[model samples]
Target chain A: MGIQEQYRSEAAALLSSGEVKLVIGFGEGSTADRRRPLFARTPEEAQKFVLDAACIANLSTYLVTEGLLSDGKKVAVFLKPDGIRSVNILISEAQLKPDQVVILGYAIDKAEITALEGRNISDFSLGEEIRSHTPPPHILQEAERIEEMNPAERFEFWKAHFSKCIKCYACRQVCPMCYCRRCIVDVNQPQWVSTSSHTLGNFEWNIVRAFHLAGRCAACGACDRACPVNIPLRLVNYRMGKEVIDAFDYCAGENSSQKPVLASFKQDDPETFIL
Target chain B: MSEPFEPKIVAFVCTYCTYAGADLAGTSRLKYAPNVRIVRLPCTGRISPMFILKALQKGADTVLVSGCHPGDCHFTAGNYHARRRWTVFRALLAFTGIPEERIRFSWVSAAEGAKFAEMINEITEQTRKLGPFTQYQELQKVIETQSTY
Candidate 1:
């Protein structure tokens, strides 16, 4: 049987056996190639579950939606390796319960969706190999290209991109890691970040967004895909991710047991820049 | 005639150490550049990178973050944590193309009056040579004209 057929059958069995209250996966969009998230609660509803390259939305983000866990019911989510990393981050950050999520992992390369052989986040990996593997060359190339520029050119490049920001915050909405209840930008006591979408505010907002995800981005490309302006957010995020790996020997979502790179530091962490 | 550029500096200092250090500098009759405006916080741990960015956004040409030396934090380990944070933040600022000299991080204990004065003088000289931060100033000018209230 094809992988799609297999996924449908497995989702059906999970729903029929009451193993999970919900099976979150992709269903048809308005067109044949389009897909949207489907939450299947019944065995028949599981038939709508789709698996393909076009089903690229990181389904794990939905797992943390505000009301989904209110009933304390179990959920099964279709996840790629990057999505799995987000689940690991959520679990480690005490934002989600492990037992409550049954991950159905998969990976798509060259248009083939192959199911990953794992049911749990730790089943994902024991070290940085899985976390650092397979960063898309396109994103890495752009990040490197930016790094090659002179500081003034780099600033101008980012400023030009930021000036186009309309502040729709679609990037924030789609990121699985941007799960703050009260984002610093929203706090108004002293207004840390201005709310306007003008050049200054936009620069501050985008920089803060990237900084907040420094060591924690899953490199899932969701933010890049979600952006309506095509801001190349993944490149900025990839730059920060590379810095974290190079400096701290850390990768986000490697395992539930690993301390977050920013939260914990070694006494010997590089300090050559400090005076 | 337009006066020579004297860079405005904002120093976020911990009350226990760098603030006292500055006070000691004053008591010792040690004269330093008078361009810096100090905002005293309880510890270096209390200084957020946002405070640094905010100072720059408001037209300050340079920012200084000074506190107790490592293991000398009044609150114990506060400066250590601050050290790690500043390291990462400093890298972030540099990667974003902000000149490294614009953001200064140092340790000045309560007794280091002369050291504090010297550091200020050095920062003032360097920033004055670099002139005003026109990039953020231009952005701020645009923001003022737009006034999205």
Candidate 2:
């Protein structure tokens, strides 16, 4: 049987046997082409769960949300490889507990799911391997194109793109890892990012937002998928991710036991830039 | 033709070491630049990256965070953690095109009063040469104009 078929059956069995209170996965949206997150409470509902390229939302975002993970109920999340890393980061930050989650690793397309089964899916050993997996040709070309631009051109290119943003924050809303109870953008006393939606506000909002997710973002591309305006927000995140990896030899969401790169320190860290 | 540009320096000093060291500099009459305005915290670990950004946004020409030397932190490992955080934070600042000289971090224990004085004088001199922080003002105007939306 196919991996999707196997996942559906497994989900069905888990739900039927009372192993989980709910199974969260993807299902057909209100329209035929759209896919949306599904909350499966029964065995029959579990059969509706689908794993496809269109299943783009990072399901981990629901872990910390109120009324999503109840006191005694177990949450079974269908995660892609990157999605699993997000879960690891959340668990390490003490935002989610291991016992509270039942992760079902859904293999991406023809990729082998058995090689990854029951092992800690949050481990980042696969980061380099995943990067090697051929991205859609267009994405690779776009990333290369951005990398070729100088910083000023890169800044202007982003400024122009962000100028179109309406500040809907759908990008923030749909990200599984952006589970902060009080987002920095919402603080008004000092007004970190302007509350309005203008060019400068949009630029600051996007820059700071991307920076906060720098070391922790697992490159799930959920923010890019969620942006209503289709801003290439993940490009900024991807650049920062590469920088973190190159600068500190650290990768986020690889190990729950490892301290976050930004939260810990080394005595001989590079300080050539300091005055 | 113009008033001398006295750069505003906000120094975040840890209570057990740098803060005490600054106090010692004062008591010992060890002269240093008068541009620095100190905000004392219990430990350097308590200083958040947001605090540093806020200081820059609010008109500090330069921001300095001084703490206990590694292994000498009153809280055992507070300065160690701060050292790691500052390393990453400074990288992000550089990525954003902010001059790295504007943000400084150092380890100065209570016995290093002379060293602390020298650090301050050095920072003040460097910042005076760099002049006031006009980048923040430009960004602020950008924010103000963009806020209309």
Q: Score the docking of each candidate (DockQ).
A: 0.50, 0.26
Which candidate has the highest DockQ of all? 1
Model 1 bad stretches (over 4 Å): B141-149
What are the per-candidate TM-scores when only chain A is compared?
A: 0.95, 0.88
- lDDT, residue A26, candidate 1: 93
> Per-residue alpha-carbon lDDT of model 2 for A17-55, expressed as tens digits?
998888888898887667788999999999998776556
Top-lDDT candidate index: 1
Question: Which pairs of residues clash in candidate 2, taking residues 3 or more apart in a chain or in different chains?
Answer: A61-A176, A124-A254, A265-B84
Q: What tens-digit string does per-residue lDDT give for candidate 1 at A1-275?
A: 97888889999998999989999999999898999989999999999888999988988888778888878888999998789888988888878888888888888887988988867676777365664475688876777787788888888888777777778899999988887878889999999888878888888888788888888888888988998878888887877777788788888888876777777777677767656
Predicted candidate 2 versus true structure: per-residue lDDT over B9-91, tens digit per residue: 99998999999999899899999999999999999899877777678767899999889887899998887777766766665
lDDT at position B63, candidate 2: 96
TM-score of each: 0.95, 0.83
For model 1, name the residue pairs that clash.
Answer: none
User: For model 1, what is the alpha-carbon lDDT of residue A215?
Assistant: 82
